[model samples]
Target chain A: METLFYDYVVPCVCAFLACVGFTLMFNIHGMGKLIAGVGGALSWLVYLLAGSTIFAAFLAAVAIGVFAEIMSRVRLCPVTGYVLVALLPLVPGGGIYYAMRHCVAGETQRFLSTLLHTFGMAAALAVGAMLASSVFRAMFPRLRRTGKG
Target chain B: MDYDKLLNMAAELGYQLMYSGAEIYRVEESARRLLYAYGLENPEVFAIPNCVIVSVDTPEGHPITRMRRVPPHGTDIELLERCNGLCRRLCAAPPPIEEAQALIAALPEDEPRYSPRGVLLGYGVAPAFFAPLFGGGLADLVSAFLCGSAVGVCLLYGGRFIGANGFFRTAVSSALASLLAMALVAVGVGESVDVVTISTLMVLVPGVALTNAMREIMAGDTFSGLSRTADAILVASAIALGAAAGQALGGFF
Candidate 1:
C-alpha cells in the first residue's frame, strides 16, 4: 500500500499539480487549464504504468495528445495550449542533465549514450504527439468543417 | 476592405499566434483561413519563430504583402486560445475589417487568469511533488520545495532584467538552483541531490520545444522543425552548462 501510494498516487498528484503550476505560469485560463492538469496526471499515470521507459514516454505523450484533442474540441481551444504543459513530466530532463554531467566529467562513452537516450526520448514524445494529433485531425472533419475549432 | 489593410491584418494575426507559441502550421493556417474568409482568394502565409509574412493578390492583379517581426514572448495559452477563438468566430461569420483589427490589437492586453502570487505558489510546490516522482524521499521533497521557491523568486525578478532572452535567463536561474540544491545536500538537509536538482530543474526544461519541433517536422515543415529543434538543443545545453558550472563552483566552496 505504501509503495503504491508513494510510487503512483503521490507522483500522479504531483504531476497534476505541477502541470497546474505550469499552466498558471503560462497564463492558461478557464476549463481548459483544469483539463490540462488532468491530462498531465493521466499522462504521468500512463508513463508509470508503461514502466517508465523511453517507449513509455512516447505512449504517454500520445495519450496526452489524444486527451488534449478531445479537450480542444470540447473547450474550443487550440490543442497546443493543453498539450504543451501536460507533457512536462515525461520530458527527458534527467537524461539531459546526466548526459551533460558525464561529458563534463570526461566520461565520453557514457555521455554519448545518455545524450542519445535523451534525444530518443524527445523524438518519441514528438512522434507520439504528432501521430495522435494527426489521427484526431483526420477523424474530426466535422469540427474542422464548422470552424468551431 | 483595402488589400493592403487586409494583408496587414492577416500578418498581424499570424504574428500574434507566433508570439504566443502556436506552432508554425497553426499560425500559417490561421492566417490563410482568416484571409480566405475575408475575401482574399489567393492568400499566401508563412510563419517562423521570428517573423510572419502574408501576401495576397489584390483585385487590381497586384500583390499586396505585409510582414511583421515578432519579438520573442513567453507562452500564454490563454491568449493563444482566445486568439484562436477569435479566428474561428470571425471565420464563421466574417467580421468587419475594423472589428477584426480591433480584436487583433486587443489580444496582447488580455489579463492573466492567475495572480502573481498564485503563479509563484505553483512554482514553489510543483517541484516538491516532482521529487517523489523522481524517487525522492521526504527530505528531498522539502529541499526541492525550497529550491523551487528560490527558482520562482529568481524568475519573478530575474525575468524582468532578462527580458526575452530565454537562454540567459534559463542558465542563470538553473545555476543558482543547482547550487542551492547542492548546498542543501552537502549540509545533509536533502537525501539525494540529484533528485532534488532534477525536480527543481524540470520547470526550465525545453520539453515543449522539443516536442513541437518533432510535430512540425512530421507535418512537413522541415525548416521550422529544424529551427525549433536547434532552439530546444540550445536551451537544454544552457541548462546543462549552468548546472555543471554550479556543481564545479559548489565543490570549490
Candidate 2:
C-alpha cells in the first residue's frame, strides 16, 4: 500500500501544481482552489493504485462532480470551478510530446504506435468523464442542469 | 504625473481595466492623495473601453458621495489604437515585467480590460467554421468554445450547463470542421495534408485542461486538482492520438 501510494504521489503533485498554476493564472475563488486540488490529487491516486488511467479519471471526475453538486446545493462552492480544476490531470500532454518527438526523429513505426496509444488513452479519458458525469447526473437528476440541482 | 507609473501600479495589483468613456468628476491632489496614495477607499471601479469610473461609497463618514470617472488613463482613438497595438506586441514580445510596467505608466490611463473570449476562438483556427452546420449556431459555438477552453484551462471553473453546452458545442464544431476538411479534400480545394492539418489541429486545443486547472487551485482541492491535471494531460494526448488514428485511417484509403 505504501509503495502504491508513493507511486501516485508524483502524479498527484504534478496535478496539484497544475491546478495551483491555473488558479493563480486565472484568479479563481478560494473554495474553488481547495476542491480542485482534492479532486486532481484523488484522481491521480486512483490511476496509480489501479494502474488504469481511464478508470482513475472516471472515478475522480464522478467524485468531483458529486461533491460539487452537493456543495452547490448547500450554497457553498461553485460546481463548475471544482469540476474544471479536477479535470486537469487527464490532458495527455506526454503522449503528444512523445509522438511528435519520435516522428521528428524519423522513428516512423514507434511514432505510429505511440500515436495510437495516445489517441486510445485520450478517447478513453473523454469517455470516462462523460460516464462519470452521466452517472452522477442520473443519481442526483438535479446535477444534470445548471440552476436547479 | 507619470502616466506609465500609474498604469504599472494598477497592473501589479491585478487591476486590468476594461472599457472607458469620460470622467464625470475630478478628485485633485487631495482626493488623489487620500484615495490612491493613502488607499482609504474600497471603490467599485467600473470600466468601459477607454474610461474608468470609481464610486466613493466607503467610510460612511467620509462626505464623498456620487461616482466619478478619472482619466488618469487617457482615452482617444490614437490611445486606443496604441493600447491595442501594445497588447498584441506585448503578447508577442513579452518584455520584462518592469518594462511592461513602464509602458503602462507612460500610456497615462487604462485602455480597457483584456478579455480571453477571442483568444479561445482564435485557437479554433477560424471563426464561423461551424456556424452553418451546428444546431446551436454561432453564439452557441462561441459560448461552448469559450467555456470549454476556459474550463479546460481551469479559467472560469464550472457550471454544469456551461460544461454540457461546451462539450456538445465543441463536438459539433469538431464534426463540422472535420466534414469541411473532408469536403475540401473531395473538391480538391486543398491538399490532403492541409485538410488533415486544419481539422486535426482544431481538436488538439485543450479546453478541459485549462478550466480544471484553475478550479482545482482556487477550491483548495490541490490533491484532486493534481489528479485532474494529469487527466487533462491525458485528454490532450488523446486528441493527438485521435489525429494519428485519423491519419492512419486516411492512409488505408
True contacts kept of each: 0.79, 0.04
Give lDDT tens digits, candidate 2, residues A1-149. 88645455544664564454344323343455566666666665665566555555555555655665665555432345455545545544445645755785689999999878766665555455545555766676653322110
DockQ of 2: 0.04
For model 1, residues B1-253, the per-residue Cα lDDT tens digits are: 6777788788888998888888888899999999889877779988878889888997788887788998867787877877888898888898788888888888878646677788887787778778988889989989998999888888887777776578888998889889999999989999998999999999889987887788789778999999989999999998999899888888898
Q: Which stretches of candidate 2 lie over 4 Å from their true place?
A: A1-5, A9-14, A52-55, A76-78, A143-149, B1-253
Whole-model Cα lDDT per candidate?
0.85, 0.43
TM-score of 1: 0.94
Candidate 1 C-alpha error for residue B151, in Å = 2.1
lDDT (10s digit) by residue, model 2, range B1-253: 3333333334322222221111111111112322343244553433322234344434443433333233223112223233334543454454555666677556635433224553343333221222111222334344333323433333223334434343343333333334444444555544443323332333334645444443444445455446546655654554444444444444554
Instruction: Specify the CAPRI tier of model 1.
Output: medium
Best by lDDT: 1
